[model samples]
Target: MPSLGLKGADLMCAAPTSLTLVMTDMRLSFPSDEELLSAIRGHHIGDQPLCGFAREFGILHEQLLETAAAHAEIARRRDELAVEVDTWVAARLPVPHPNASLHTETVGRLLDRIAEAQVHAYRLLMTISPDDPRVHAAWYRLAELVDGYTDLTREVIQRARRLPALGDRR
Candidate 1:
């Protein structure tokens, strides 16, 4: 319950370095774009030759690969941050914190952040060209994920409100 209490807030706060913090280190430096691409290539693509489809799009492959790497890196970092936040929340929030409004307020703040991130992602997606298959593909994937996050955040907020409504927890 403490995790649900804070996991979304932290994830909502720093899901990516873009979402917020750079858990890679306190130096605030992120891996270079080239480094991220290389890491992805080594793990997944692994000497896979680009087909004629990629050749047709030229630079599209580069952008798509970078975007994919960024996406995966963000997801990875979010999980890392969640573990850290969970540990802190477990200590502070406990089984029944002195105030349930804390849960409600934290979750409410998280909901707002999730909504903002989703809206920002959607606005950027709209600015992209529909005719461009490469970008649209990435946009579609991102839009789907953000929408899901928005839904999940809403659900968490609703559940958190229940603790307060139950009487003593509040």
Candidate 2:
């Protein structure tokens, strides 16, 4: 879908028409837990993040939240991580957004946008003098939290992905 102020089919005109185009144009496929962690760490500030952002594209399959009779852990961890990430990010916001206006974003984009804010926080800390222990401490804590997020997300990908072995039983 187009973003706010984006008009017509042009929404994706600038965006690549396929995954291959995205990988070739910016080489930012998630492809692994490490890359996602790097994104969470705010390392990719250029077209890479936009491309890496593409990694998030098809990763949020509903199967990732599957809760079968045999695999209760899938559901449990998904719910746990969802709440944990949301609560942790909410707590870190410098100030809450006042407007509750409607949005057209997909769930993945919403999550990505929040993660971007966390990255922005790191950006702010980086600009501060390193001599200041206070900001560095906060930055360290944020990094740790982002690591935790990466772990949870990786687990979701590993166990919850709808492999052929898993089938469509759920």
Candidate 3:
């Protein structure tokens, strides 16, 4: 309900004067901080108290926006620095064989395939009635497949662990 000394375009460019804007009239200036604080401290619900609170809240809002921008810039700089360090470290390290990650790739692909098969099996099982004899057989089949997959995964992990490290001829 009070003017904030800001016009149409100036509204976006000017420093915040109050927490709200209702009309574009002349800016309603407040008294000095000391006087405003004294009035606010007295806890009176008048013009000075309202103005004091609005001024402080507007300033806090601006400060919070600035703090958020600063944090985002810091995060961006940290990410850039991390990339630079990674690049430097990578350049200093020995390159591995092209197929160094083959096992991992294979494992990832197999896992994806297994997940797809399991989803299909589940859908099929859902189509059959719970009381059907075939439903019980399907459940047993799913259990067996899951057990086999778990055992296979364990064996693969064990074999991988026993393999020689990269660049080691022995």
lDDT of 3 by residue, 30-72 (tens): 2232332222222221453233233333333334335656655
Error of 1 at 51 (Å): 38
Clashing pairs in 3: none
| TM-score result, candidate 1 | 0.27
Off by over 4 Å in 1: 1-79, 86-130, 160-170
- Stretches off by above 4 angstroms in model 2 are 1-34, 37-117, 160-170
Look at candidate 3 and tell me the lDDT of residue 158.
Answer: 34
Q: Sorted on TM-score, highest at the top, how do the candidates line up?
A: 2, 1, 3
Question: Residue 40 in model 2: shift from native, Å?
Answer: 7.1
Ten-residue segment with the worst summed lDDT in candidate 3?
Answer: 161-170
lDDT of each residue in 1-170, candidate 2, tens digit only: 11222234322222222122122223212223334434344333223333234223212222332324534554454344444333432232222134322223222333443454454444556677766786666657656654544443333333331111111122
- What's the ranking of the predictions by lDDT, best on top? 2, 3, 1
How displaced is residue 67 in candidate 3, in Å? 50
RMSD in Å for candidate 3, one decimal? 27.8
Q: Which candidate leads the pack in TM-score? A: 2
lDDT tens readout by residue for model 1, 1-170:
11222122222211122111223323112222222222222222111121111111222223333575565654443344334333332232223323333334232223223333333344455776656675566656645644543443333333331222222221
The local distance difference test score of each candidate is 0.31, 0.36, 0.35
Q: What is the TM-score of each candidate against the true structure?
A: 0.27, 0.32, 0.27
